[model samples]
Target: MILITGTAGFIGFHLSQRLLRDGEEVVGLDVINDYYDINVKYSRLAEAGIDKNEIEYGKLVQSTTQPGYRFIKLDLTDRESLNQLFEAEKFATVVNLAAQAGVRYSLINPQAYIDSNIIGFTNILEACRHHVVKHLAYASSSSVYGLNEKMPLSTGDNVDHPISLYAASKKSNELMAHTYSHLFGLATTGLRFFTVYGPWGRPDMALFLFTEAILKGEPIKVFNHGNMVRDFTYVDDIVEGIKRVIENPPKGNPEWTGESPDPSTSKAPYKVYNIGNNDPVTLMDFILAIEEELGQKAEKNMMDLQPGDVPATYADVQDLMDDLGYKPETHIRHGIRNFLDWYREYYGYVTDQGADAGAITDQKKQ
Candidate 1:
């Protein structure tokens, strides 16, 4: 069986659904915290046949829709309970995706990042160590490449200079995973994801926020005075890359040497790869894609780059393509359209005579 943490999250939800569709027995875990809108999280769970009303903390509930899937409402910081779940389930593979996400929020509440990303990740590592999991794949972020001006950020690039606490926490996860891989011989892979956006994406994300603000006739915040670039990856493509990584556990590289150590791989059974579109889109162009999809212009609120924000992020996914023989193929406009459609449907918005109109009823606004 496979254990997937953060199953209520965007990428995690999509991945769990995909794995279940592929006939894999899966156990999902999430704390269901009110990080954003709890309603959205519950809706995602409901879509997976795990009713929100049926969820009780620390209890496992079977999916009503997908026979092969089950879910548990558990926090990673609760090591005893996490260990107990691991012991009982005997999960062969584990994917750790639960973390305190958001760069800007990290600046305001650094403790949340430390609590969830650092301490919680340690608990996960401990559970995996004792449970004897075959392979462990976890989420890492491209934000770890902070202050890196290099174009097309590669896994081998030095990421020791993270600006945000959130990025530092993720970098800490990579280090912790490497320690486990080196000492316990636990096979672990770290995926450095770029800007992932699609259906059921986090409301705090740029795409969702932009869509919500645009549909509400509010000005969308365009940071860095619209001079930003990102390797906007689609959620489906991200999940596909993760699925391949989960199946192919890394073997320790014999060619690896301590003299000229590669940051992406180690002599231990540990590896890191950049999973992105390898195609950078400018901020203006990204907004233009949304405008084209919605057939309405966004009221721009151009501003300077906020603290803990990067001006640009471009990924070099050559290692992923070379090793896994896969690359993200979703176009930006297509991805935006998919997200916009889901947004409108979920929030009860509609196009009225060539213009979006309706009460979105966003819980986040409450």
Candidate 2:
């Protein structure tokens, strides 16, 4: 059996569906917190065939659509309950994707980051330690590369200077995972995800916010005076990389040495991979792709870089390629168009004003 935390989340939902389709018995966990919109979270759960009416807090409920999949309304911080779940399930693999996400929100509520990213992750580590799980794959973020002027953020790069509480928590997660792996011989892999965007993505992300604002004729906030870049990875590609990593857990690197250590791998059974497109798209070019797809221009509200925000992010996926023989290949134009199609369909927005589904490729070629 496989345990996937944050199954109600964007990446979690897609991953669970994919695994279930592959005939894996998946036990999913989520508290369904209203960090953004509860409605959206519930909608994602519904897509997983989990009826809200059937959910009993802290109890496991089977998916109505997929028999191999089940979900539990639980919190990672609830250590005792989490341990019991791990004990009973005896999962062969675990993917920890649940974290208090968002860069700016950490400034408003720092405690949320501490509770979920720190304490929750600690609980996960403890459970994995006691239960003897085979492999643990968890989500890290590109934001950990904060304050670095490097072009392509690599796992080999030092991430000691985190600008936001969220980034610090993620960095702490990597450190904590290493400790566990070194001490207990637990196989763990941490994924530093770049700017992931796609259908059913988080509302707080730029893609969702900009799309909603454009459709409503509102001004979309363009921070850093519209001068920024992101390795906007598609959700599917991120999941694919994760799947590959899960199948191939890190066996302690034989060449690792203390005098000259690689930040991505260690003598312990642990590894870190940069899961991204490796293509940094300018902020303006991304917006233009959206505009071309929607056939509408956004009213831009230029602003200075917000506190706890980086000006740009690029991912170096060479390690990922060499290890897993996989790379994210989704282009911005195609990815944006995919998101637009899902947004329109999910929100019941009429397509009369915008180009039809798959027209994003056509517009990109023009």
Best candidate, lDDT-wise? 1
Tell me how candidate 1 scores on lDDT: 0.92
Q: Distance (Å) between predicted and true CA of 266, model 2?
A: 0.6
TM-score winner:
1
* Candidate 2, run of 10 with poorest lDDT: 357-366
Q: TM-score for model 1?
A: 0.97
Model 1: per-residue lDDT, tens digit, 11-119? 9999999999999999999998888988888889989999777899999999999999999999888988999999999999999999999999998889999889999
Clashing pairs in 1: none
CA lDDT of every candidate: 0.92, 0.92
TM-score of 2: 0.95
Q: Give the total clashing residue pairs for model 1.
A: 0
Q: What does candidate 2's lDDT look like per residue over 1-366, in tens digits? A: 999999889999999988888888999999999898777778888888898888988899988988998999998889999999998999999999999999999999999999999999999999999999999999999999999998888899999999999999999999999999999999999999999999989999999999989987889999999999999999999989988999999999999999999988999999999999999999999999999899999999999999999999999999999999999999888899899998887776754445553464233222
List the candidate 1 regions with Cα displacement exceeding 4 Å.
352-366
